[model samples]
Target: MTSRGPIVGRGRSVSRRTFLASAGVTVAAAAGMRGGPLAHAADAVPPQLTVAVIGDGRTGVWASLRAGAGGRNLEQDLGTRIIWQPGFTASLPVMEAVKAGAVDFTFATATAVVNAVPARVPIVPLAAYPLPADEVDFLVQANSAIRTAADLKGKKIAHQNGTTGTYSLIKYLESAGLRLSDVQAVSLSGADAFTAFAQGSIDGWIHWQPATALALTKLGDKARLLSDVKTYDYAFYVARGEVAVNYPQVLAKFMKIIRETQAYIFAHPAESVALWASQGGFPPNGTEQAVYEKLVRDARLSESTAVALKPVDEAAAASTQDLADNFHALGVLPNKVDVRSFLLGAQFDAAKQAVALALGA
Candidate 1:
């Protein structure tokens, strides 16, 4: 594995690197593409993977990887085509699509993954990206009298009803000896929540980074950080259980691509920020740069550390299980679910090994 360190921005540029070791392999390698040794076979053709992606531009790094620097097109080098199904900005809706098998894979919030299990979604977690506690928080008007979570009682709090934001808000309130009932929980999308807060329709808005950045930028002195929350918030990759069982190599290759892309992002911070800004519809200025830096800090992974892939570890599983427990108690989940049934760590490990051997990496 490459020994690239954590990706920090010092206003430096790095050359692009190919994700594949050799581009010489022929299309006949598809037989071995099912997580086995790459060997020649008859009647083989390249496979296409359909990925449901976020439309909000937060995941534009994946696009940069696919398109490559100077239009290198790494997906062609890997002998695969990616059909990107977009129009999603939040994890809850994305999870619903994946649960219905509308797409092959997606990266969803851990809260959505946990909630899906009880809803009988046949999905398995492939890997987890732990986010820093401050990535999500409560925002209030800069001049609002509500100074703490306690001040939220009897006041309107806005959040995307079934997202990690809501879960984080619940955790934040609980830590302050408050419950969901204490506040008038208003279910609103991130944009709507921001609008409501701006109009003083909502006392506070609980949301994630880029949205928070936009709010602070537009509202300026009107927006204030009322609560900085830290929770077991994770952005996790999940695939339909059938895919993990029957086509492990596809998932492994996808993981390898993401790992490589993550390393590249770390190596070229400025370029990455620009790419993300262009893709996510943010201005490539000091404000967006600051948010990107905060995202990197909260991600807390070096390039070397980012390459390690496990299906789901104990801590992640426990955190997700705890989410399920809390949601069940809060009457969010109709029935309790044993999260272990949906995790396929051992299988994912074998698949990764098989992919390494097949790719000769």
Candidate 2:
């Protein structure tokens, strides 16, 4: 396997040298198009993989990858096309589309994924991405008396019930020796929660980053965070279970592309964020858009080093199962979910191996 070192790289493309150089790693024979053996498993590549995009789904890097991140077109490298289904409000809604086959893959929370299993959503986790615990905070009107989690008692707090936001809220309440019942927990989409909070419909919003960046920027002194929260949140790359079983090669290449992209981001945070803004990553470029961008950059890069994509494994299953059990215990979930049934670690072993071989690990 590549050295268990931090991802590091630079320049316009994330070619193999970037991996061996700054990342302190070596790679397999660079004998194919663009000096990458990404297409070794091309024969197994399907026509297209429909992806759910909240904000281009890291296309800033994927675009560069598709256009030739390593001196070759990644479409030719991976032998597939990406069909993005954009404007998803959140992962819970994305899971709905996944069930109807309108979407094939998405990055959702373990909370969302676990909830999917019980809802009969035909999706399983492809890999795990540990989320930054500090990315979420409680946003309340600045004039409100709620300065601490304890002050939130009896207040209406908006959180996306089945996603990481809810998990964070539950954890936050516990820190204050309280329960969900202690607060009027309102389940709402991110957008709605923001609107409602702005209009004073909700007492507080358990805001997530990027949106949190924007909320703080727009609300200015009108809103202040109740307190900083550290959450045990994780994001999962979930796909239709059949896809992982049938197209190991494609999934493997997808993982490689993401790893390379992550390296490139680490190497060129500015360029990556610039591309993000240009690609409508942070839209509306309002007068304060730059301010929002800066805040989001701090939020993202602060913990970007922790981003790693690996096949869902036993430890991952147990970790998420505990979170699932928490929801069930809180009475938010109808029944306990066996995270193993939906994480697909066993079924994804072949794809994981394919990824290892491609990276010359």
Span of 10 residues, lowest total lDDT, candidate 2: 1-10
Q: Candidate 1's residue-wise lDDT over 1-361, tens digit each?
A: 1112211112332211111101112223322445564322111223666678776434445556654743446567555677778779777777778766677677777777877765656565667656555667688878889897778888888988767788888888887899888899988987888888889988888887667766787788888887556545566776655444345556666666776677676666667667766665466776866666555544532122344444456777777777777777777777887765445333244333434543345
Q: Clashing residue pairs, candidate 1?
A: 7-266, 142-222
The reply for model 1, stretches above 4 Å from the true place, is 1-46, 56-59, 69-72, 277-280, 283-309, 344-361
Root-mean-square deviation of Cα positions for candidate 2 versus the true structure, in angstroms = 10.5
Per lDDT, the best of the predicted structures is: 2
Relative to the unseen true structure, what is the C-alpha lDDT of residue 339 in candidate 1, on a scale of 0 to 100?
69
Residue 254, model 2: Cα distance from true site in angstroms: 0.5
TM-score of 2: 0.78
Models, CA RMSD each: 10.5, 10.5
lDDT of 1: 0.63
* Superposed Cα deviation of residue 104, candidate 1 (Å): 0.5
lDDT of 2 at 270: 57
